[model samples]
Target: MSSVPKALKYSKTHEWVREEDDTVIIGITDHAQTMLGDLVYVELPELEFSFEMGQECAVIESVKAAADIYCPISGEVVEINELLLDNPQLINEDPYGKGWLLRLRPFENDFKELLTAEQYTKLVASEAH
Candidate 1:
């Protein structure tokens, strides 16, 4: 079973978002890291870059495969996790914590489009079955 933090909002694509004032902290969900299998490299978008909702913003390469990281909402990138450059496996170790990817200032409060923990768990379960 994958770890799902109650405080975060999740996208179907497996990105998690934590709202902090006007900025949202983003990262791949535990389920995502498990599926990717041992992260090796992470390609992050430049700060100040703007992306539409569902736009591919980054790429995470693991021993099993490479996965695209999508923006959960339209936003401008504010910050990125530089530590991941040295330890990509932090995503596998603590996805919800030290593995966070970037921060974004959203265009709107459309976070409701994201899945809840219960919904995400069902989605993952269905995928497994």
Candidate 2:
């Protein structure tokens, strides 16, 4: 099973969202990284670029495949993890922490509509079937 932090919200596409002050941090969930295999590259969205909820805004490439990472909420990107440019393995090693992909200033508080950890866990289980 993947590590699903109870505090963060999740999306059907497997991105996790963490709210901090007025910004929201986004990253791929542990299950997503596991399925993709060892990460070799990360393509993050441009700073200040706005994306609607569910729009593909980034990409993560693993030895097995390249996956599109969707924005969990409509927002403008404010920050990105520069560390991933040099070492995408951080995503395979610690997906929730130093591997975080982007930080966004949300246009609205629609984050409340995202899935809870338990719901996401169930969704992952269903996908395995």
Candidate 3:
């Protein structure tokens, strides 16, 4: 089973979002890291770069293959995890903590469109079937 922290909102694509004041902290979920296997490299979006919801903003490459990381909402990137440049495997170790990908200042009022923990769990379970 994959770890899904209840405090975070999730995308069907496996990104996690944590609300913090006006900004949202983002990261790939444990399920994502598990699926990707051992990570080798991470391509994070530039700081201050703006992207639309569902846009492909970065890439994560593992020994198995490369996977695109998508934006969960329209926003401007406020910060990125520079440590990943040195050790991308932090994603596999602590995806919800030190492995966080980026922070974003949202363009909209609510992130209600994002999935709740229960919903995301169901979504992942359905995918397994």
Candidate 4:
């Protein structure tokens, strides 16, 4: 089973969002990283670049495949984890923590429409079958 932190919101595409003060941290889920197999590279969006919901904002390349990471919400990218440029392995190691891809200043704070931990868990289960 994949680790799905209850406090975060998840997208159907596998990205997770953790809300902070006026910003939200975004990253691929642990299940996503596991499926990707050892991350080799990451492509992050430019700071202050705005993206509409569902826009492909970044890319994650692993030994198995290169996956496009979509923006879970409409927002302006505020910060990116520069550490991933040198150590993409962090993603495979701690996806929900040190492996976070970027932080965004979302256009809004109401994330009720996104999937909860339970819903995401079910999604992952359904995909496995």
Candidate 5:
């Protein structure tokens, strides 16, 4: 089973969001990295670029395939994981921790509306069928 942190909100596209003081942290789920196989490269969004909710903001390339990473909420990208440029495998190692992708200053905390752990679990389960 994929590790879905109960504290984080998840997108249907498989990204996870963790709310901080005024900004939110983002990453692909454990399940995402597993499905992508061993990640080899990650193309991140420009720092300070603004993205709308559900917008494609980055690309993660793996031995298996390349997957697009989307913004879960409308926001300005305040920071990006530059280290991934040199070490994309960090995603496969610790996706919810050091593998985090970006930080966003959201227009609003609409992430509250995203799927919860239970909801996402069901979604993943349904997809497997």
Candidate 6:
């Protein structure tokens, strides 16, 4: 089963976000990494890159397939995980922790479109079929 931490918010594209102070941290869900299978490459966004919610911000290539990562909220990217450049498999080992992709200083606090843990659980369950 995929881990869906209750404290974080999720996107339909299978990304998760955790708000911290003025920024929101973004990463793929456990289900995403499992579907992709053994990530081999990660293309991270540049710092200070501005993006709208649902915009394509990064890419991940796994042994099975390549997937585009969408920004969960509108903001300017302030930080990216440098560790993933050499260790993309961190995403498979720890999807919610050290595998976090980027941090964005959001444009606003409107997170009405994000899903709760319960909602995401249902989403994953529906997709299982």
Q: Best candidate, TM-score-wise?
A: 6
lDDT of 5: 0.94
Q: Tell me the RMSD of model 4 versus the true structure.
A: 0.8
lDDT of 6 by residue, 21-99 (tens): 8889999999999999999999999999999999999999998898999999999999999999999999999999999
Q: For candidate 1, which ten residues in a row score worst on lDDT?
A: 1-10
For 3-63, candidate 5 gives per-residue lDDT tens digits of 9999999999999999999999999999999999999999998999999998999999998
Local distance difference test values of all predictions, in order: 0.94, 0.94, 0.93, 0.94, 0.94, 0.95
Q: What is residue 91's positional error in candidate 1, in angstroms?
A: 0.4
Error at 7, model 2, angstroms: 0.6
Task: Flag regions of model 6 displaced more than 4 Å.
Answer: none
Residue-level lDDT of model 2, residues 76-95, one tens digit each, is 99999999999999999999
Distance (Å) between predicted and true CA of 115, model 3?
A: 0.4
Q: How many Å off is the CA of 116 in candidate 2?
A: 0.3
Candidate 1 lDDT, 1-129, residue by residue in tens: 888888889999999999998899999999999888999999999999999999999999998898999999889999999999999999999999999999999999999899988898889999998
TM-scores, all models, native as reference: 0.97, 0.98, 0.97, 0.97, 0.97, 0.98
The per-candidate count of clashes, in order, stands at 0, 0, 0, 0, 0, 0
lDDT of 2: 0.94
RMSD of each: 0.7, 0.7, 0.7, 0.8, 0.7, 0.6
Error of 2 at 79 (Å): 0.5
Off by over 4 Å in 3: none
Quick one: best lDDT, which candidate?
A: 6
The lowest-lDDT stretch of 10 consecutive residues in candidate 3 is 104-113
When summed lDDT is taken over every stretch of 10 residues in candidate 5, the lowest stretch is 108-117
The residue ranges of model 1 lying beyond 4 angstroms of the native Cα positions read none
Model 4's TM-score against the true structure: 0.97
Q: Report the Cα lDDT for residue 117, model 5.
A: 89
